[model samples]
Target: MGFHSFESPYDWSRIDTYRRRAEQCPGGLVDLSVGSPVDPVPRSVKEALAAAADDGQARGYPKTAGDDSLRQAATDWFRRRRGVDLDALGADLVPTVGSKEAVALMASLLHLGPGDRVVQPKVSYPTYAIGTQLAGAQVTTVDDPANTDSWVDLPGVRAVWINSPGNPSGQVIDRAGLSKIVRAARSIGATVLSDECYAMLDWSGTTQVGQNVSIPASPCILEPGVCGGDASGVLCLYSMSKQSNMAGYRAALVAGDARLVKAMTAYRKQVGLIVPGPVQRAMRAALEDGEAVMAQREIYSRRLRALVQALTAYGYDAVMPQGGLYIWAQARSGDCWADMADLARMGILASPGEFYGDSHRLRFSSTISDDQLELALERLHTGA
Candidate 1:
């Protein structure tokens, strides 16, 4: 029941009603409300998974800490792609079922509970609050995390969650802003968990803060500049779901703070939260295939361009996201439900901002197929 205190489920009946209404249109429905990938899996990843499965090694229980190859691949990925150097063979990382599992369990594994506080962005992925509440911890929403001073002094604050190329908003925090939050959290003895799942999908190659600029993907919590090359009291979570179209494989990992990772590994082992061995092997293959990842990014980029052009022509204020898979946009009237109705009438469906702690915008995902995207664009153009 306490979990219900976090937030109510989205009005799916409303979505269903809209779905039925939209189906009556000649173009059918183009659901851009969710970011689930519609593309095919990379051949390398699929082959690797098939090979591992044929080997029949999955009959045995897999290690909760993941195998050495997987860990090393993850380390190499951070260094090569994210500019964060993690230990190649140390107990500083562990594979997770998915980033969602890690996000939801981090608070509980850290032993946060009643009377403690978990600070998360006011407009964020809903799971942050759910995880805190599941741990019996209170949630403190921070509207402007760039202003670290606002949350640093909050009493009982035990953990802070930061998302880059943030969901819903698609805003990437700069290196200096991340450093300030990390420093503030460290000063108060709280752990900072940076969710960098969308780090590699940065639309803007560089993040600009005034005149100073840095690679958008390199401002991770584990980045040397962000944490002074010290991973103490900090952790970074990443997922291959978005980057590699491996969401069904549940491939994700948490790295940073050897002690913290070790503790999480031990707890997860006892609780049977292990990644499938076959999935682990597939993840390794996915991490090593940089070409496939880049190609996928370009596909999404094209879709983004199409959506922005069409939405702009329709008189909607389409916010060009710096990164991530979704386009955050606002109706001229600033009424999300009105926008939702308009979209439904055009046989389109987008996630309303109300679902992500905002009430005046909608999120359009770029993960749809090229044909589906074209249909959505045509509808937008014709005001169908």
Candidate 2:
């Protein structure tokens, strides 16, 4: 097998090993390398799941395309949160195992092959590129989707990915900026897949607290006017994992372009890729309750403020995150591992920027507890 090694570029096992080493330290570790929310699920959702589990009907084979209630809930969510009346999405709506798996499988279903190009962000979640490779498509990294010049000349580019509230960088593309990319891609007949998984966590209010500046959250490809009434060549992927602390539930959905989603649904039905019945019920509860989502946001917001201020005070150049759980920071001394090693010595673990894309940067997560965060502040002060 002349298999190309997409797995080699990312070493999750190596990353885990480093985290384990830090965990073994006497003081215990504040593991911020992974962005898994260490928060409790809303009681409403938990109860909903429990109720669904006991309904007896859930024992039957789950609806592979998603249940009617789940699809309707997704539609209602789009109208309330996204400012779009998307009735066409109901039949097209299919609950995913999770957004990551949805993205990975999307390329294969789209029929991308060896010569096709899958354009993605220069610094991205890595899954986008890996998915493209799985379908034998080439990965083209576009540093800025807002800039038309960055993608105007790429050849054979079948699909372009835009991630708002980016994973490692925490950058968000504004409406006008996103409009430009959608126009450019549409002109060349390329599909745009916008990953707005972290759109719910906007931290724009705390930028001026210190030397760092926070950017505001903005939706790019989903802008109704930019997408031209019909979402023919556009799609938006979102997950309840971050917003609702339902990462283990594997609940997520892709909305947009009825035709595209319908094709995806057809392929998915054959493959048995569906969110379990109980998880779908849980997602419905999670989506309908706005208060619970905001409460979770507050938890992350408070932690972000403390960590951003602490990193700046410690002489590390912490680039205040615009949105999302990560703060992209650079070493004042310009050595990435030196900074990581320094933090690790104090039992604070962070993901190196090299894992995302470029070297010489590091990412800190705001998903830790308040108590652990305070301890991290102390470690930062003492470690440096």
Candidate 3:
């Protein structure tokens, strides 16, 4: 009952205040506070959704575990893109409405409550803490999540949430770093749940395996070296929102650890947390079309470069993200709210770091349209 008393993690008051100020600016606002995609969904995915919708048989209640085709597509995607072999672990995968729901429901689904401690990144998506709270579990923040020593011996730690290409910061953890965390969590008898929603949008070309083999992709927790080629005690949460522009469809899934997936799937079935049939079909189509994913990635990359250049020219220290849809920036003033207000004065809106558990940085999203990005850049350069 105490968890039920907790307030929502999002503070809409800040957004409302900024929205009102932005409305009064001379030019129309170029909103970049959130990372929601502005581009249209791929034709292949949309066609699949339409076909599924036209199928009268798809109107029936869908399976909570997802269709066999979806599961197969997800597994094939992991093998082809993430360099992870999940062929034998097909039964461990289950589609969720979206990665956010899986994130908010993981602790409860795992039955962690009353004195159980969940380890999370110090600066992370707030939903992780909210989910732990919802399960009556305590949260422990590790500032350097990639450092295994930071969490190896934490008392009462039951679950660890790893977010590579992190939300607010866009920081990525390499395979070696992920392996360290996995080993540490295993030693402590804690489960690891990795959020990999932005894996496909990697901007860094430093994904080297061993000495000579380089793969230009974000490191996955389920990578062979990261988890010793075994997915036991680990789960990965992925979404088709960023890569496929399917955020509205709410298509995502959790894969790894057969027992845990079975537990969550059983609970989700009872509660009706199923992804719709049409969305699942769309997801399968999206997973199969690698070319579409690459095309979307290139769009974000261009937007990211333009935004970073504009922010840099405006006297802000904007760092290029290795992956993910945000550029973590800091102003010389050392005040996030002050930087946010300045951007608002320029008719450009960005998220303050306070919302993401940090106070000196701001998050600028690169998911805006090309025209809007150009407008934002023009405003920054012209001081309009």
Candidate 4:
């Protein structure tokens, strides 16, 4: 009931202060702050959106639970892209505006409040904490899931967030590691919600897609291999923003735990949180085209290599991102914002580590255009 009681993890003040300075910069700022993709949406997706918009029936109110065709596409995409067993997931598939909203609202839908707690990574996307706070729940930050010590003593914890190829760290949780956490969560009768928005971007050399790979670099929490066989209290939140460049379309889905999905769908329907007709069309088109997603992945791979090498040359040791469009790096000396300021002065602006609950590290995104990426590399080399 109290508005000011909710605490946000992000440094809203600092971000606003930085925004002002970035606006005045010479070549306009080379923003690598948020992981928003800047690439153009695929033509297939665009064409679909336009066609849906021009349809006479599209003018009416869209279905809150998503159209049958969109749901089927979501079903197919998970089966083909993530290797999730549709039968195992059961009736637990529902559409959302995007993964961000789904991730944040899941806490509330579960009725987590006051005494309840949510466990999340120490270095995590800020929304995890914000979501818990908004639900009137406590947040516990764990550095690694393999540490059983961190799992005990949190009796009131109802959910544990697992972000593979994590947002800020780009660390992939393998099958063995995932099994440990899933077991721990299940033991406590808690749910394991995996934010796998970046699961399609694994880059550990062996391709998770195409012809050669056996196991994926990033394992899904609901994967039979990772869960040792059940998706009991699990859910995977995914978005088309990253892989398909559909950020503006707000296309995403929640899959797993049929009961949970039903509850969420009811709540969402009551609140009118539905994807637009045209956006749903675009999502279906995007999911149907695996080639476009692969092409996008290759582009990110090249940019990631360039950024990692350049950051190393700039005297920063960057963690090799196993997947995702980010490179986590640490400056040899001083705080990360100081490092960010240095980069900004050199004409390249990187997200300060502080944003992701990390003080000593910085994140570089590989979502820029080729020319901008080359310029960023050049600036890094000259320390401009």
Candidate 5:
């Protein structure tokens, strides 16, 4: 009841009120709030989906576990990008319709109810807590999710949610920080779910500090240094929405801990929650399209850099994040809603910090179109 839900008037309603105010500005609204991708879907992914549909492969129901090719592509991605070698049999990997549902349904899938507790980051993707509540489980939050002692020691803690290149903050936890969490959670028999949806979008050149893991972006929970190569109760969720511009395709996967994945697969099948057959093929193409992913990263990097510069000049304390598709910045006004009001005056709409549990800063998404971003930047610079 303490947290906002739709029935209780979720933050979106409040944010929307601000949005409407922005829409009334004489210059017209240039939305910098929503993180939906405006980029084109990778050519390879589109080709694969079209091929599947044209070949009549989309006529039947999809396997909830995902086809072997889709699952294998996931494992291969883990090995190539995450530097983590999952099970050779690859039963540890399973496709998800999209990472959001997987995240929202995680606690329910585990059948966790009232006496159980789920720990999540104070400012993270909201679905983690939503899922816990849907399962009738208690929710706890920590400022630093990778600090195991902060939540792992809590009584009856059954799950800990970790988001590297975290939402709203874009902070990445290195291997040592994550390893401590993994070890502590495992010691107490709690499941650790790492949301790595933005894994491929790091702008921070931060290293794995004390480890030799050559991960492409953020250090993954399934990495050897973090999990000690044993995925007993770890689950890493990856989404292609941002990187491959495949949000509409709902392509993503859960990989790690064969038993956990196997159990989730069973439950998913019962509910008919399978990725469409065409989407499954598209996911395979997306995973294999490293060039497209890298290209998208370059595009976002430029936009984020430009936004940071423009915001700083416009009296905001701005900097490129460690990783993720957002610019986390604090405005001259100090108050988040006040900053939103200031942006609204310029016909710009950015997410108020309170929407993501942060009252000190607003989030500007890099998923905007370049011309609109340019207009937003011009407005900020001129204080028009």
Candidate 6:
């Protein structure tokens, strides 16, 4: 299950060329390539972490399955925010150091191996393929995540990874769409892993693809309307990074099938993959602080709105994403590298569509400061 030498699925050298070009501009580079949070971590979360650190009870090794309070908080958050009703005893929830690890290790954690097939959207985070490869599984892609006919027939299907408010694409999947995938996966006994990390940043009415639901954000895979309230083989991964500005904390959790949660928790314990006590407390604080989350959402809304208008006028044919922090703009002939070259000349660094398995677009993150965004706008309005 291990390779003798490390190989990065992403080609950093390719992007570095554009970064160098952007750096050469007189005004300096306005990097919009990454999704890292640039805002301050919420005060309540920091206070909770500090309190936990000093408490004698929290100084010891934390539970791999997560503390009772943290688990309850996660379950409650799902109910109030995502319309997911988890088990009473919290058997359906397990905290991870971050959602990324959970995502990268999911195929293996589910005991998938040689000959097993894992399906994901064509335009998706690269980690999905990495995780599948690590587990000795085959990877397949469907152009549309909601199209059940596209993936239901793949041989030896074991897992399905769906990200809404998708990375790079910034497209949100509606409830009806999510339900179709759940139904298809169930018929084939495939486990579905739903990444709803950006679910809280729903920029409704400007969606490029799916319609925004009545929920506070995007439709969740575990919602009753989606899975019929039976989370038998489904899991939803949520991160506190973007919404709570807790990226540094590396706090995230997965909620789903009780059996599956128990299995993954056991595997994690055996591997000593546990969230630190203080971080666990911090995550619980984030889950309860809805006001702080909403404030952060509004901040992103303004930033994303500003970028969409700027890119549109710059002739990128940009559409405001329904959710997530990215602005997915059109590129000539779906030539991502060419788009990168064009943007680089303007002293703007962005992610090429090739990075996300796309043909004709580029992604710009809105996580930079307002001043940096204004700088980008200035550069866009004029040439480098």
Task: Give all candidates' CA lDDT scores.
Answer: 0.84, 0.78, 0.85, 0.79, 0.83, 0.84
Off by over 4 Å in 4: 1-4, 12-28, 205-217
Give a tens-digit lDDT track for model 2, residues 124-240. 887888888888889888788777787778889899888888888888777777778788888999988899888778665421111121222345355466565667788889899
Q: Please give, for residues 294-346, the per-residue lDDT of candidate 6 as tens digits.
A: 88988998998888888877778888887899998778546888888988888
lDDT of 4 by residue, 1-384 (tens): 221145654764665556556556666666667778889899999999999996642898788778888888887776666666756646468889998898877788888889988999989888888888888889899898557569656779799998987888888887778788888888888988889888888886533432233334466777677665566788888889998998878899888888888888888888888888888888899888777887888788888888888888889887568888898887556687777666666666677787788888888888888888877888778776
For each candidate in turn, the TM-score is: 0.94, 0.92, 0.95, 0.93, 0.94, 0.94
Candidates 3 and 5: which is better by lDDT? 3
TM-score of structure candidate 5: 0.94
Better of 2 and 4 by TM-score: 4
For model 6, the stretches where C-alpha displacement exceeds 4 angstroms are 1-9, 88-91, 205-215
Clashes of each: 0, 1, 0, 1, 0, 2
State the lDDT of candidate 3 residue by residue for 84-191, as single tens digits: 777544338999999898998899898889888999998888899889989889888889777777777778889999998889888888888899888988988899
Local accuracy of candidate 1 as per-residue lDDT tens digits, 1-384: 123245544455756776777777786899899889989999999999988885545878778998888888887777776676675323288999999999988898998989999999998998888899888899999897878888888899999999988998888888889899989998999999999888878986664321122233535778777787788899999999998998898999999999999999998898889999999999999989878887888898899988999999898888679889988887556887788888888999888888788878888899999899999999999888
Residue pairs with backbone overlap in model 5: none
Error of 2 at 308 (Å): 0.3
Clashing pairs in 1: none
Model 5, global lDDT? 0.83
Best by TM-score: 3
Deviation from native of the Cα of residue 16 in model 5, angstroms? 2.8
